[model samples]
Target: MYGRMNNNIYILLFCIVFLISIITFTTIRIITDKEREFKKLPNLKAWKYISILIIVAITSFYGVEIYKSATNYGGKLAWFIERLKNERSVKFEHNNIYEFGVEGIFEDINKEHPLPKKLYMASDFDLTFNSDGIITAFDTFVYGKNAHGKEETYLIAYDKKKSQDITIIRNGYANPDYDDDKLVEPLIKTVNAIPVKQTVSKWNESKYGLVYYGKRNWGYNTEGIININEDGKEHNLEKSTSEIIGYTVSIFVPGKEKEVVPARYNLIGDPNWSKANTNPNQKSSKEKQQDLTNSKEQFYLSKEVGYKLNITDKALGSTFYSLSKTIDGGKTWEVINNDPFNGTIGSASGITFLNDKLGFLVAVRPSGTEGELYRTDDGGISFKKVNYTPREVKLDSGQSISPFDSPGMPYEKDGVFNMLVGQGSDGDYNGNSSALYQSKDKGETWEYVKEVKSS
Candidate 1:
């Protein structure tokens, strides 16, 4: 960027120099030409001298101002060029982003950024809030798949003043696609991250912790010159061409943690697909046959999905909300009003485990006019509609420009499901602002709340 600016300066200077040279040469030539004719009218010499003086003065002033501004711009441009070049040399290889703790007030990221951005999943992670309800940290989860088909898990972190300093906690490569089945889809294959408690402590115990750093002005909050290694490239996290990653999702349910990942999402063809293998569509046989086989044998099961006892409410799209049930360590998702809710709660933008019982899902309403949030009571199988927008909105990425319609949901409390929702068919659905909405009675209603934002 700096180099580009420098080139512009040079171009401007060249134009100025060219014009000045032409004028100076033209003025001298005119004087010489006039001299030939002036012998007949000598009084014109005074006019000639006056014209020469005026031209010299004007060009000299122009040259001075141009030189000063150009030199100043050139120096600044040099500094920026140096910084950018250095950034490239020590890029994504550095992973010491967490060195800077929470440093300033968590600003509204939606003001400038496109929600659900490609760099990270827009509104799926939990917001780490301070004791005062102010957001202190930001986080999201994501599934990383390499070209060789090795899947890896990661936790991306954000904080006020230094949100991009992510920390990679638990990482492990996944099994090979023995079937070479790129087309196989799963019932639940992704995860939604929820933030719990976070440390506001400083790096190196050096008085530079979030508490140590005064609020607002964050000049001293140096997370350090960490390299922005995105997708193996040394680039700035803010302006990288990396894929959007929110939270690390796994069908790896807490209770079903021990179960191995199956080959396909649907056991449809698998004879074990029906615990009531005799007839899954039959109502009487469903009750008559006590299928003792693993639930995986009957239907699609994934650690990536939130489980419940019974689900009635649903969201639109390709998911089946009533299919999975998570009983042991997680929340109970017993849902009601299935007739009112249609569609599945699978592969949506954000999903969070609020405590062990309450949960949030960002999905489209049946009418599809606005985005909505769904709540689970027992675990899975049913859901209740909450007055929440479905996804985040964004107007533009440049100049921090955003329209009212572009309200977005970007981040949330740790471990809590956060999402962005608003009106319109956004150019990039993820870029819309996903600022959060708060509801007390299980999303029956909602109210204004702090929005997730960047530094």
Candidate 2:
């Protein structure tokens, strides 16, 4: 870039010099011709002086132009040019630039696991491939919320050796539980190398609780420089960073609609159905379901999957919520569960699904019991309670809240789930959460990714 700028400066100076020479010569010739016509050399010296003055003025004008051009070319233009050049280089050898055949591997993955038809499945992957162009693993960051309804980050790792994928929530760089058949050491190193914490930090910084860095928005935090080797040694990567003011989303266009749509949202309040459930005589099951459904009737439609949640008082005055998903728009809904509590001594708070069959639910008791997590593999036919402890929501006022309320529905992208856990007095869906948790094993187990402050 500097070299090109220098060349331009030289060319501009040459043009200025050439123009000045012509102007000076023209002025002198005019004066001389007038003198010859008059047949007298009257004030020839003064005319010469005038010609010199004219040349000086012309030179000064061109000199200013040259300086201005240099300034623009070096300041804004230079940065733009360098960025463009780098981008072009990346595009030209995009497949091999990041790593040999990185693009090809992505293309293959997309072709092999095309987005699910009749379902809004935006399959966006954050991937790291081996040197041989074999995809070793990938990650998906959830901006909105997970099955548990908290906005957090989850990780789904693919081990080539095992030919299987496993999800896990990060606990401050702690390694996830790997299956016995897979090699844990390499997968651990790869997961650790990814800037999962940094990505979550960006999401927390966003007012809308999101971090999507890619080629969709005019190079806004799109590209990076990194090295990949077999040793698993830490490589310093220079990433382009952006301070996104709010959460923005675009479904990885494929299955149904080839468009990137922003995730629509609404805030939920304290369980109003508590009274209806507490007094079964007050409201019938249908009435209670309608009430719960009416409150959360608004749904956000991604590519193929549409998510809607209803919190109602169904059992013993406890909170009962159902997570309904529609694959064919609003025409039909395949719910994970009709009654989230299911005789358990807790209230359903949040829900999220990684796919059709695998899903998760969050529940808490009104009697100050710790939050409990449940998972279902057969599309919510039945859920098994998982033994997991949750972190308490520490308020700014030095008070603590438990059984995290998922104001924002849990967001699931790829195979990862993100949820925010917090308690608020206002009873509205505000992101004033104490912590964010990520789960890869369909919410069966979650690890603390980070603490998120209310935005």
Candidate 3:
């Protein structure tokens, strides 16, 4: 598809260049000819008329050609955009793992799409817990054969304990035999199961919106953003799905939970508000960088100074990771510096500030060599590299791994900082089985402690 588009662009460029060359040649000849020679030329009026006619003919021909080309190209582009903007209905031949861990199984069903007596495979498929580990909501991925035994995937939301269903999504894939209840058109936007971290954790409680993308579908292919609560309660956000493509969205913060920010890639209430178009086909590199700069931001509030820090991560490029300060609770932000963090961040990164002037930043090093750790004493204005012995530990599977391979959030208590670094047992090598290390002197020295298990 891209190759064809490139060919079209090449053709258009060639035609433009050819027209410009012809016009330039004609003008040069007209200007260079001597007045006597030019005037005395036989059939000069005929030549002038002929030239005008030829130019008009050629212009008209190319205009029509260009118009046809553009129309066809525009039609194809619009089709592609539409395909992207909507949920794609697909057929399932066998059991397959679709995007967002959505598994489709060709199975048997009765005359209606009734609740399964038992899940084909079970164990917390959709139940999301609260901070206290209590079930808050369950976004069930209901898949079964309909009246005709055609396989279909359905979505339904339920409150805690799965006692009451609140919403149902009818994707029109297979009309499930409804029992008196009118089947409202289900919003087919794919969503990953919202983890308890986003639902109940304090770090994510103050977010503005929700952003989710599947691993198989990179970028905006399988991404969704909405202003609905975890239980599918809509807040009138009315945002188009396309607008959430490149945004790193989160939920609304406390006291602002009811606020609905429009579709924007950056912070909603930012003083320097800029809506970035994340469409790869329509956006330039500079625009993408700006959008990324606004997407991944970390906020920290100091108890003593009452100051707030916002660290923006512009990853996957050479753009600097900026540090911004907000004196008044995120109403406005001023960029303090973008140079403090260099080669200290990767796609998966995190930042933590102990106070107004003390903070730690860690990121996976470029090319996955090791995790880089940085510390800021004077409120993130400047950072100094802190050295530690990267743990080389063995898991139960007898696989050798490095702690720096999978860096995680640092836990600090009584000036004793425990860096919970673990080597991922999974294929991705993310630190799943973690080990805790003590760094009493603020990341200067480290001592290995017992292995820590992720709760």
Candidate 4:
């Protein structure tokens, strides 16, 4: 029945077009013959009305042809015009992983960092934080096909302290029905840039914004960003779908979550993966991908592009894992540093940030038999110990994994373990899982406080 109906529609359209083509050709031939044959006068004397109809028909065909010709000409003209009119857009010269992670945006620090002019943050698939501090905005993944399904990822954020949901984008992990053995592709889908609820205590100042990275569906990373603003996310389990994946940054207007950017001006990042979590290796399974991570190296997200930069198995004996960045307002992104982690960090369950330029990323480095907290001073270029903090976080050897991993190993080591330095009413960052901190002389010393918090 369906096939017959489709065939009927095709036949009807074909007949109408065929008839039009034949009539137009025949009329042109008749007009040409008349003109050649001693001025037949187009049979005007016999029927002026007929001649008029012929004129209308001929003109209509000619009109369409002329319009098509003009359209093509205009397109050609446009191509040349653009070449002449626009100067090359300002080019952001590429830099290395160390260059990308440098601390240069700290010129604007003041005694009291005023209410943020703008803010944004992204987290992993399963959320760990309750949206505290500058971890400004996020949305809970509502299951049951409303937007996100069982393996769906939802991106939520706010410009300010309001309930407005500035959805960036969403994507599914993998299809259970396919049995592809593919663990979600590691691109934007793999690393959930979803911010943990906890933040760092005080000590330093620098540029600020969220760091979001993704893995899994590398091609459809743009679709994730699209999901942030629109309703009805993509569902592979069901049929019929539309989506685009990529990354962008937004200025959360004071007192509002409204995204205020010039239309079509999505400040997209390096055109590597579609979105951050787009898995480059869809053909491989989850276990195979994990098997590759056992070896270690130091990974860095430079503006660099090449086979060497894109895929890194290890760095410094530590697997260079995933990393995130918030260049635009929308989707979170993976640092081109796209390798495993340089060291073991997943055991340290929390993350915090001050800004884009300078922030502290804390993680657990297994010291002998136990895990110790390590701090990254400049994003991840190099890490150091917290001034007064202990060398390592000792854990019981009987436990198979570190403390944070006991919670189902939700977060990956490299990007997940982090901390921030901020001040509260009491003024001190006193090693609280979540709280405010104070530094008397610009990070040379510090203290922690539980009163007011710093995000």
Best model per TM-score: 3
Error of 4 at 20 (Å): 99
Question: How well does candidate 2 match the true structure, expressed as C-alpha RMSD?
Answer: 24.6
Sort order, TM-score high to low: 3, 2, 1, 4
Residue pairs with clashing backbones, model 3? 207-251, 208-251, 209-250, 209-251
Q: How many residue pairs clash in each candidate at the backbone level?
A: 83, 22, 4, 109
- Tell me the tens digit of each residue's lDDT in model 3 across 1-455: 32265657977789799999989986787788857557777747898899899989988986676555443223344334433532232222221122221222212111233533322210013333333433344343334445665544443444534343233333312212221111111111222223324333544442222222111111332222333333434333334333332212233333443344322112232212213345547866754443332211354353112222232322111123567776753445667766666644332255677777877766553223345567788888888876666667676899986654455566688868888765532323443556677887766667878667656
| Per-residue accuracy of model 1 over 227-346 as CA lDDT, tens digit each | 211122221123322211111212111233234321111122222221222333443443322221112112112332333322222111112333334442222333333432355322
Candidate with best lDDT: 3
If both were scored by lDDT, which would come out higher, candidate 2 or candidate 4?
Answer: 2
Question: Which sections of candidate 3 miss by over 4 Å?
Answer: 1-296, 302-320, 365-370, 394-404, 424-431
lDDT of each: 0.33, 0.40, 0.43, 0.29
Rank by lDDT (best first): 3, 2, 1, 4
Angstrom error of the Cα, residue 265, model 3: value is 12
Better of 1 and 3 by lDDT: 3
For residue 441, model 1's alpha carbon misses the true position, in angstroms, by: 5.0
Worst 10 residues of 4 by lDDT: 101-110
